[model samples]
Target: MAEDRRKEIVRHLSEDDLDRLLAETDDDKISKRLTFVKRLYKGATLEDAADDVGRSSGTATRWARRWNEGGLGLLTPNFGGGRPPKLDEDEQDELIERLRDGQPWKSQEVQHLLSEKFDAEYHPHYLGTFLRDLGLSYAKPRPKRPHQPENPDEILEERVDDALDEDDQPHNKRAGDDGEGWVVDEDVCTDGGTVIGFFDASQPQPYDNSRRVWYVDDPHVERPLVKTEDSAVGFYAPNGESLVTFTEDETKERICEVLELIREQNPGKRILLVLDKHGSHIYEYTRKRAHQLGIDLIFLPSGSPHLNPIEKVWDYLKWTMCPIIVENEGEFKILVKDVFERITRRISYAQSWCEKFLDLQKLS
Candidate 1:
């Protein structure tokens, strides 16, 4: 009876059935089973067929036995037991649509939202894969401001004179035991400058930065919609000391106020301030006031924020604090101040900026 059943099974699958099975099945194991059975019906020995398809002879024999008992019905997947999906198809479709409503969502925020809305729980790493499967991707969000400077190269070239020698090595400075009386490149400051710092201002926005966000790319993408707060001027000193204050405007008055703060902090000390050429910075009154306060304002060439090591501090601050998502100006100021304090408390950060110039050998 078993011999007759095996013969019947062999006759049941035609060449067309074999081709269709191989073409339609995507599962690797199922495709291997079909190939094994088809080869057996094509005058191949059980061992030969198993060897051709890289299957064990025992696996081939077991599958053949099942086929003889139930024909093709036994070959179909059983489709049983595993963890169910956290979201149904409809819910998944809705979640994708909700994400499209605008603004990128952080991975943690999205994970929390999933738990609240659909009672779904996922490991943070797995959540990234799940998001990609749903046709979402990670992207960096940048601020879209008008008339960004295009002369960073020129600015860098200008500063290179102050940093490099004729042979392009660092222009080193000699210092006393107290690390004072060092001259960098020349004309950097008087014989004994008190403090060295980078000065700049930035207007942070409500928009997020320095974090991965879930976003769908459209061919015709526009800048992200974001709200900005009032600007702040800052002076970052070599010892990681920073003077940051909120300003309603970037006028000469505000510039003078910040300089006064710098003067108060370094009482009776000369400051070598590396800054850019904003109209307020170049204003006759601002320059005179800076000179009177014993602050030598060294202007950076056009469009050169990269030369300012303190710019890195601004980048770090935005990435660390902006993603927290403050609603009002009050919260924004408080959070920014707190984060700034935490960052500047480390003296190592200040030394790192100062080392860039100090490491160079003195120009002979």
Candidate 2:
């Protein structure tokens, strides 16, 4: 260890040069080596720099010597490949973008793409690692509904944008803006302004809802089972406000109760409830009540439950209560109440209904 090493405490690669190398590198080993050299340049003893990077003093000393002699080239490890990568960094990134074009590409498909496009051949086995490095993975792709709307996001965004835009203009006779199917109630404000809510219903048993849980050994529970025709009506606002009440059944009259509940929550504002085309939801009784209460019911295209964000809330509730077992209806009611309080309706829930809808809407 030579004591008279550096006159200035910080002098290596000019800070700008070191930073540019650090910024450009994706290899952790090279990053660590550069960091060790950085500490040395900043007047740290070899031992201290080694400790900082979790390397031994001997390792640090070697890195410093290598960098001083050969710069980053010697500091960086060698891949030992006889030839340069067939796909350079930019080309690799471009390939990743193409692979992510909403197709569930199998390894063979990707391999064929590589061969055809880049004139590079990769074995199916080698492709797993290659794809992972490019931030891709093998997993079951989620299925899309056959009847899912091609432009649900554009449709929703336009509806919301137009509703909001109406406030700026004089409220005229609002008609034929969204076509006939768009109008569930003919009486509400056709001009503008609406607070959106996603509405849905689910039937859960009194006994238990189950999902896979972590366990070392197989687990079992001696649980009592009871079946009841109890349904829960839920209104989930994107800003995390939600109202869920147990109902006897999702009948037309019961749907009216939910409309009134939503109106009560929104007060002076108009309510636009997005829900599936359940028979009870679109029934004349529900429509009339919604119009009377200053609410508009937007019927999702038939068989399209995916359009309503509230369904995720119900799925999450069931997932969280999966292990919980309530012996009687009383206990089950208590459980539901306690769990509901904890369900933080993240603003993300609403954003999921809007912001992310466009990107996912076009998926086939």
Candidate 3:
């Protein structure tokens, strides 16, 4: 037969044979043996295979010789057995202590430190495994905060009381109709000074949504002469051809003017006016005058602008006026007039936008 009558005995090696080979040979030597086996399977002579695979003919012949003698067991590796660690228990404890104290040390850092300090050349990965075997793990230290005073309970109690007091206060209450009625909305105008003036009306509704539940059937309807501005003092309403400005004014003239407008608009009907809790709006004179005009001035809760419908109207005006550019005061006024005209004409569209706003608030 042709030697062992097999063209490629390399293919017939079992898993156990391969394991033995790997166990018997180091990684570098096994690599050389694998190359030789490949060449031999490809029909190269033993001598040629040895030379081609960078092994001596004698080593190649020895591998072939072993194969014929005892099958594939000759290729396997054997790990020599050892009793125990050479280092004492105290030494291991010292090593662990040294490692723990010297950290901020990565495995590679520890390995480098070992080589530099103790003339030990350890692979980084092996060092990691060794540390893990010794029950050492990487961990981050907790950060410390500044020391606080011990009597924080008093301060906390005071804060809680203040919060509760604020919560207990009445918020945006709807104004009762006191014979002087007005609509709260924005008005756009072509005034000679600014392109647009925001006319905000402060009239009280029968019920406040901030304080109680109150809904309008036609909340989106554009009541005439309502003008809002993002830049102006407040919303405005038409005072004849000119616009009347509403602000948080304490003066009697402004308060009287507002009262007069409400009485004029609603006639004999009691007027409800919702107003902010500004010092000016809360003056005794303003309140007395409003009472005299049959107007009930309901004060809006502090710091809640969203409760006011006039604020929403102003927002709409700003949205509408964003695209219009005014070169001068005249152009600005014209643009404002045009915007108001468009808004007035497209009443349904304005209504839809307002409805959408309400819907979004609901969803939120």
Give the candidate number with the greatest lDDT: 1
Tell me the spans in candidate 1 whose CA falls farther than 4 Å from its real position.
1-193, 209-228, 347-353, 356-364
- Model 3 lDDT, full chain set: 0.46
CA error at residue 41 for candidate 3, angstroms: 63
Q: In terms of TM-score, how similar is model 1 to the real structure?
A: 0.43
User: By descending TM-score, how would the candidates be arranged?
Assistant: 2, 1, 3
Which structure is stronger by lDDT: 1 or 3? 1
lDDT score for residue 39 of model 3:
60
Provide TM-scores for the models: 0.43, 0.51, 0.29
* Per-residue accuracy of model 2 over 186-299 as CA lDDT, tens digit each: 434433344667888887554343555566776664456755567878887653246777888888988888777776666655666677878897666566566667665566
* Whole-model alpha-carbon lDDT for candidate 1: 0.66
Badly placed stretches (over 4 Å) of model 3 are 1-252, 327-364
lDDT of each: 0.66, 0.65, 0.46
TM-score of 3: 0.29
RMSD of each: 18.5, 12.9, 26.1
Give RMSD (Å) of candidate 3 vs. truth. 26.1
* Number of the top TM-score candidate: 2
